[model samples]
Target: MDKQKAQIWIARVLVTAVFAINVQCAIQFIAWPESYTYAYQLSGASAEAVVRGYGICFLMWNATYPPVIAAPHRYRVLFIVVIAQQLIGLVGESLLLASLGQAAGLGTLAASITRFIIFDGAGAVLLVIAFALTMRAARSLKEPAE
Candidate 1:
C-alpha cells in the first residue's frame, strides 16, 4: 500500500522471476540426458560435475529469497545474501567451465566460457543491480521524509 511496500514487492517479484529462470536453465542443461554429451563437453564440464554444481547453485538461490514483502529492513540483509550467493555462483561456474575446458579441448573451453559469460554474467549483473536498488530503497524507507 505504501511506497516502501511497493518497492519491496517489486524487488521480490523481480528476484523470483530471475530465480525461476535459473531453475528453468538448470533443468534444461543439468537434467539433459547423458547421451547429449556435447552440451556438457561444450561447457568443458562433465555431466556429473555440472549436475552437482547446479544443485549447489539452486540451494543458494533459494536461500536468498526474502520471506516476506513488508519487511524493508529485512530485505537489506536479503540483498547482501543474494549478492554473496551471486559471487559464489560466478566463481563456481567459472571454475567448473574452466575445468571442463581443460578436460575437453580449447574449443569446448571457449564454448563454456562464452555460455557462462553471456548468460550468467548478464544475470549476475542484473541481480546485483536490483539488489543494490533494493538496498537503497530499504535505507531510504528508514529515513524521515523531509
Candidate 2:
C-alpha cells in the first residue's frame, strides 16, 4: 500500500483508540461517583459538586490528550507532557479531597490506580502503536522532485 494510505489507516486506528478510551472514561465516571467524591473532598468540594465538576474536567483532559500524542513527530514531547499531566492530576485529585474536608483511604488509592491502568496505560500503548505506524508511513513517502 502507498504511504499516504498507510498514514490514513494509522490515523483512523489512533482516532478509534481515542474514542474507545473516551467511552471507557465515561463508563468509569458513571460507575465511580464514590471514587470522585473521595478525591473531591480534598478540594473542599461537596460530593455532588465534585461529580459534576470532574465530569467536565475529565472530558476536557481526554479531549486534549490524544491529538498531541498521535502526531507523527514530537511524540517524545507529547509523552513527557502526558506523564506530567497525569502526575499533576493525581496530586490535584488528592488536594481536592483534602480541601473538601474529607478523609482519604486506601480504597480511593486503589481506585485511582485501577482507573489509570484501565484508561491511561492502555491509551499509552495504543498511542505508541499509532505513533510507530505513523512514523513508518512517513518514512515510506518518496521525496518530491526539487
Candidate 3:
C-alpha cells in the first residue's frame, strides 16, 4: 500500500489496540476484580471498588476512539486529545511507580506498576509514532500538485 494508506492503517490499528485494552480492563475489573487487583497487591475493603471504578472510567474514555479509527483525517483533531489522555495516564503511572518503589523498594515493584510500564509504555510509544506518521501523511496529501 501507499504511504498515506499505511499511515492511516497504523493510526487505526493503534487506536483499536487501545480500545481493546480498555475493554479488557473493564471486563476484568467487573468479572475478576480480586484477580485484577492482585497485580497491584490490593486487598481488603475498597480495593475492588477502586479497580472497578478505574476500569469503568477507562471504558468511558475509550468510547471516543472508534470514530478516529473510521476516519483519521476527520478525527485528526481528536488524535491530539487521545495523545493528551495517554500522556496524562503515563504521568499517573510514573507517579504510581515512584510510590510503589518507595513503598516496596527496588527489590519488588508492584506487578501492576511493572505491567503498566511495559504495556502502557509501548502503547504510548506507538501512539506517538502513529500521530507523527498521520500528521506527515496529512501534510503530504494536502500539498499542492508539484
Best by TM-score: 3
lDDT of 1: 0.61
Between the candidate structures 2 and 3, which one is better when assessed by TM-score? 3
In the range 57-140, model 1's lDDT, one tens digit per residue, is 665566555452234346566566666676776787777666665554457556755676566666677666666556667676
Give the CA lDDT, 0 to 100, for residue 105 in model 1: 47
Per-residue error for 2 in candidate 3, Å, reads: 3.5
Cα-based TM-score, every candidate: 0.64, 0.53, 0.82
TM-score-based ranking: 3, 1, 2
- Please write out the lDDT profile of model 2 over residues 1-146, one tens digit for every residue: 86666664775577466656665665566566665666433443456456655665667665655555355333435544554555565565556445545345555655565565456555556656665665555556542211
Q: Which residue pairs overlap in candidate 1's backbone?
A: 44-100, 44-101
TM-score of 2: 0.53
